[model samples]
Target: SQQGEEDPQALSIQEGENATMNCSYKTSINNLQWYRQNSGRGLVHLILIRSNEREKHSGRLRVTLDTSKKSSSLLITASRAADTASYFCATAERSDTGRRALTFGSGTRLQVQP
Candidate 1:
């Protein structure tokens, strides 16, 4: 599988702080996506950075992609306790044709304490 690898398996911080997570992959991908899961429930799409793109931002979320390094990072500003969750990065093969067969990283567990 082409699942990406994440670092800092776990993280903890107080509310109003910022949370940052990273992902690394071995193979080429069409795009990299960041998702958040609360209590191990469903995943919520946070951002998607295309291989050709360098960086993107949405609301309080900022994502940076380094295709040369095959790595990506997600940064959340002013994090809140409600932001506590697991963040995952999934890689889609360059030839993917709309399938969930994507390989996902182990994910970073973030804890935002109030």
Candidate 2:
């Protein structure tokens, strides 16, 4: 599997702080995406950075991709209690059938203290 692996399996921080998570993959990819899942709910798409891009930002979230190193990092600035969730990094790669396939990491569990 081309599934990525997230670092710092869990994190705890106070509200208004920043949370950062890293992900590393084994294969080449077309694009990488970050997703947030609140407890038992579905995953919410956060950001997507193409292989040709080095960095991208959305709201208070920043994502950086290093294609040479096959790694990516997600940074959430001014985090809040509502931002507590399991963050995952998904990589999109072209499959043998010429279709894009997504592989997700184990995820980083973040807890923001109120």
The per-prediction tally of clashing pairs is 0, 0
Best by TM-score: 2
Error of 2 at 77 (Å): 0.3
C-alpha-based local distance difference test score of model 1: 0.89
Q: Tell me the tens digit of each residue's lDDT in model 1 across 1-114.
A: 235988779999999999889899988888999988888499898898988999999999999999888999999999998988999998887874666467889989999999
Model 1 misplaced stretches (Cα beyond 4 Å): 96-100
lDDT of 2 by residue, 1-114 (tens): 246899889999999999999999988888999999999999999999998999999999999999999999999999999999999999998466647868999999999999
TM-score of each: 0.92, 0.93
Q: After superposition, how far is residue 54 of candidate 2 from its true place, in Å?
A: 0.2
